[model samples]
Target: MKLISWNVNGLRAVVKKDFAEIFKELDADVFSIQETKLQEGQIDLELAGYHQYFFYAQKKGYSGTAVFTKQEPISFKQGLDIEEFDDEGRTITLEFPDFYLINSYTPNSQPKLKRIDYRMRYDDALRAYMLKLSADKPVVLCGDLNVAHEEIDLKNPKSNHKNPGFSDQERNKFTELLDSGFIDSFRSLHPDEAKYSWWSYRFNARKNNAGWRIDYFVVSQNGKDLISNADILNDVYGSDHCPIELDLDIKGE
Candidate 1:
């Protein structure tokens, strides 16, 4: 199964940039999206062979996430089952006959770490949710997780030290999650490759290839063998962040 994840930055804006063509070109079996920045009924996508599901934040045009899959899931749910976390509509869980897929848009700590506390809570909550699901069956987690876990993850780690997405606290939280029996799919395969998934729109970051490898496809350790391929599609463009692809050997059944 070919699964892909991307933080479009803004779904509406990207759609205007020929997102339909791009989507058709990628042709993912499951396309998970983050930072949709829209509410229900804001846009209509005519993806003939896909079933689209979206979780919109309570606040208009803010944080949101979506998933489009060619096969129908046995069950699906929105949120992490926490009221505050559910408010921003950052997660969607789909249950297939074989495993569970969690598409997430992790909260940013914001400038100067203003929202660090909230972000930490989000990380903890999400980790717990993943752990809970993993206890029952293997889980596939994907999306823009916000933090760049290691020095090799960002183009300039020293300069970005303690920044919202590069702080020690944020990085530790990511470490903790992985320690709780998960695998960072991309880094596992391309250990030393400096390919990045997200870049700043400012300072011509994308043009210069100055970016962070924040978007991910994390699998439960139990399902690690299911990963067939993981890659960063730096060549595709529609938003500040590029699309990430993860291929698995399993099917919906």
Candidate 2:
């Protein structure tokens, strides 16, 4: 099975930039996207042979997530069950016979960590939610989690030390999540790889290869063996973030 995740930054904008061709080129069994930044009826996508599911934020043109799968899910849901967090439409869960897939767009802590408290609360809630899902089935969690867990996860880590995504608190929470029985698929596959997925438009960040590996495909420990390959498609671009892929040996019912 091939699963892919990307933070489109803005779905409508991507569509105008050959998203359809890129989506068809990837040809994944399950494709997930974050930071859709759309409200209901904002746009429509016609992806033949795929089941499209969207969870849009209550706030217009803001945080949102969606999933497109060739296989029908046994069940699915939106959000982490907290009203405040749910209001942002940051998560979507799809249950297959063999595993639970959670597509998430973790909230950014913002400038000067202005939203650190809320971001921390979100981290706690998400960790608990993923644990609950893992207890029942191996979980596959992916998206622009908005944090670079370690120094190796970004270029110029020293300079970005106190930045929003590289803050000690955010990184520690990510560590706590992994410690709770999950594996960062990309890192596990390529321990010394310096590849990154997201970059800023300013200062020619992408051109200079100065980027952050914020997008990920994380799985429950039990599901680690199922991952055949984990890749960062940095060459393909429409948004600030590139697509990350996971090739699994598991089968769906």
Candidate 3:
């Protein structure tokens, strides 16, 4: 099956920028979006062959996520059952016949590292929740994780080491998550690839190829052998972040 995840930045803004056309081109079986920044009735999307599921943040015009899938999931969940994290509308979990799909938009640490504590707490809670889910079935977790896990993940890691997204604290949390039975699908497939999925809107970073590979498709370790491919659509435009895709061949076990 083909699954794609993207942090659209803002769904309303991109819809006018050929979002629908790009959707058609990708033709994924499941498409997940993060950082929607919208609420109910703000905009309507007509995806002919997909069933839409959205979880909007209680705060207006803020963090949000959505999933559009051609196949109906056996069950769907919105958050991690934690009120503190649930308020942000950052997660969506879909239980299929064979696996669980967890789509997330991780919290970003502010300029002064103001939200670092909260972001770390979020990481702790999310990792525990994912581990719990994995006990039942394999998990396909994807979206804008908001951190560059290693030097290879960003163009200028030395200068960014102290930056919010590239901080040691955030990177270690990601490493912990991977150590807990999850595999970064893209890195696993193309270990030497250096292209990124996100670029800074400042300083014409995108034009200069200054970017960070913060988005990801992570699967449970047990499901690693099922992965066929993982890719980044860097050429696609509209948002500062690009779409990352993963293709898996499962026998429906």
Candidate 4:
């Protein structure tokens, strides 16, 4: 099975940038998108062959996520049970026959670290949610997690240490998530690959290859053996963030 995740930044903007063509070309069995920044009746996307699921934030034109899958899931969940955290519409969980696929657009620690405390709380709640789902079956967690996990994850980790996404606290939360029972699929497959999935739109960062590997596809330990390949499609264009792909062999599992 093939699954792909991307933070399109904005759904409407990317649609005008040939997102439909890219989607057709990739033909992933399941494609998840984050940061859609749209609400109901805003834009109509004609993804013919895929079943679409969207979770929109209470706030208009803000954080949101969507999932398009060729194989319809057995069940779908919008958010964690916590009402406070669910307001942002950051998560969508799909329960397939084999596993749970979670598409998330993690909250960013905003300018001046103003939202750091809230972001940390989000991390705790999200981790607990994933763990609970994992107890039932393996979980495939994917999307823009908004954090550069380690020095190897960004081109200039030293300078970014104090930055919102690269702060020690955020990175450590990611580390703890992996240590709990998940495998960062791309890192497991390409241990030394330095290419990134996201680049700052400022200062010609993308052109200079100054980027951060903030997007990810993480699977529970039980699903690790089924991972066949993981790839970062840095060459693909339209958004500041690129798509990350994961292939799994689930026939035997």
Candidate 5:
């Protein structure tokens, strides 16, 4: 089975840039998108042969997430049972027969680490939530986690050490999550590969390949064997962030 995750930045904006064509090219069985930046009725997308589910934020043109799957889910839910975080429409959990698929757009620790506390709270809560889900079955978690876990995850790790996404606090939280029986699929497969999924539009970052591997496809430790491949689609462009793909051996219910 093929699964793909992308932070489209903005759904409407990407659509204007040939999102449909790119979507067709990928042909993922389950496609998840984050940072959709939309509220209800902002736009309509027709994805033939796919079931679409969206979680829109209360605020217009803000953080949001959505999923498109060829196979219907046995059950699905939005949010992590936290009112404050749910207000941003940051998560979607879909249950198939064998596993739970979680797509998330984690909160960003703003510049100067202004929101580090909030981000930490989110990290702790989400870790607990994923643990609970994994207790039942394997879980496939993906999307822009908003942090570069280690020095290898970004082009200039030293300079970014204190940056919002690369702060010590945020990175340690990621470490704690992995220590709790989860796997960072891409890093597990490509230990030495230095690739990135998100780049700033400024300083010609994309052109210069100065980027951060903030987006990910994480799975429960038990589900690691099911991952056939994890990839960063840097060539595919629409948003500042590119798409990440994961191929799994498991199938839909």
Candidate 6:
């Protein structure tokens, strides 16, 4: 199965770009999106041969997520069920016959670590949530997790040590998550590679390849062997973030 996860920054904005063409080009079996930045009754996307599931934030034009899949899931859940977190529409869990596919848009810890506390709480909650789901079946969690996990994850990790995504607090949480029986798909496949999925728009960052590997395809340890390939599609562009792809040996079901 071919899976894709991208932080479009804004669904409406990227639509103005060549989103349609890119979507068609990738042709993912399951295409997960983050930071949709839309409300109900917003722009309607006509993606043929796909089932669309959207979870919009309570606040209009804010954080949101969506999934377009060629295979219809047995069932789908829209939120984490935590009142505060659910308000932002951060996650969507789709239950297939074999596993649970979760699409998420993690909350960012703003500059100066202003929201670090809340971000930490969110990390813990999401960790517990994934663990719970893993107990039943393997879970495939994909999206912009909003953290540059290790020193190698970002271009200049030394300078960004205390920054939001590269902060020690966030990085440790990621380690904890992996210890709790999850595998960072990309890292598992390409151990020494330093590819990135998100780049800052300023200072010609993309041109210089100064970016952060924030987006991810995290799979439960129980399902690690299913992953065939994990990659960062740096050449594709629409938002500040590029799309990450994961191929699994999972048969069509």
lDDT of 4 by residue, 71-95 (tens): 9999999988777668889999999
- Clash totals in order: 0, 0, 0, 0, 0, 0
What TM-score would every model get versus the actual structure? 0.98, 0.98, 0.98, 0.98, 0.98, 0.98
lDDT of 3 by residue, 1-253 (tens): 9999999999999998989999999999899999999998898889998999999999999999999999999999999898988999999999987789999999999898999999999999989988999999899999999999989999999988879899989999999999999999999888888989999899999999999999999999878787999999999999999999999897862
What lDDT tens digits, residue by residue, belong to model 6 across residues 1-253? 9999999999999999999999999999999999999998898999999999999999989999999999999999999899889999999999988889999899999999999998888889999999999999999999999999988899998888889999889999999999999999999989999999999999999999999999999999989878899999999999999999999898752
lDDT of each: 0.94, 0.94, 0.93, 0.92, 0.94, 0.94
lDDT of 5 by residue, 55-155 (tens): 99998889999999999999999999999899999999999887899999999999899999999999999999999999998999999999999898999
Model 6 TM-score is 0.98
138, model 2: CA deviation in Å? Answer: 0.3
How many backbone clashes can be found in candidate 4? Answer: 0
Per-candidate RMSD, Å: 1.1, 1.0, 1.2, 1.2, 1.1, 0.9
Q: Which segments of candidate 6 are over 4 A away from where they belong?
A: none
Using lDDT as the measure, name the better of candidate 2 and candidate 6: 2
Winner by TM-score between candidate 5 and candidate 4? 5
| Model 1: per-residue Cα lDDT over 129-214, one tens digit each | 99999999899999999999999999999999999899999999999999999999999999999999998989999999999999
lDDT of 2 by residue, 1-253 (tens): 9999999999999999989999999999999999999988889889999999999999999999999999999998999889999999999999998889999999999999999999999999999999998999899999999999899999999999989999999999999999999999999989999999999999999999999999999999988778899999999989999999999898641
True-vs-predicted CA distance for residue 80, candidate 5, Å: 0.7
Clashing pairs in 6: none
> What is the TM-score (0 to 1) of candidate 1?
0.98
User: Candidate 6, 153: how far from true, in Å?
Assistant: 0.9
Residue-level error in angstroms, candidate 5, position 160: 1.0
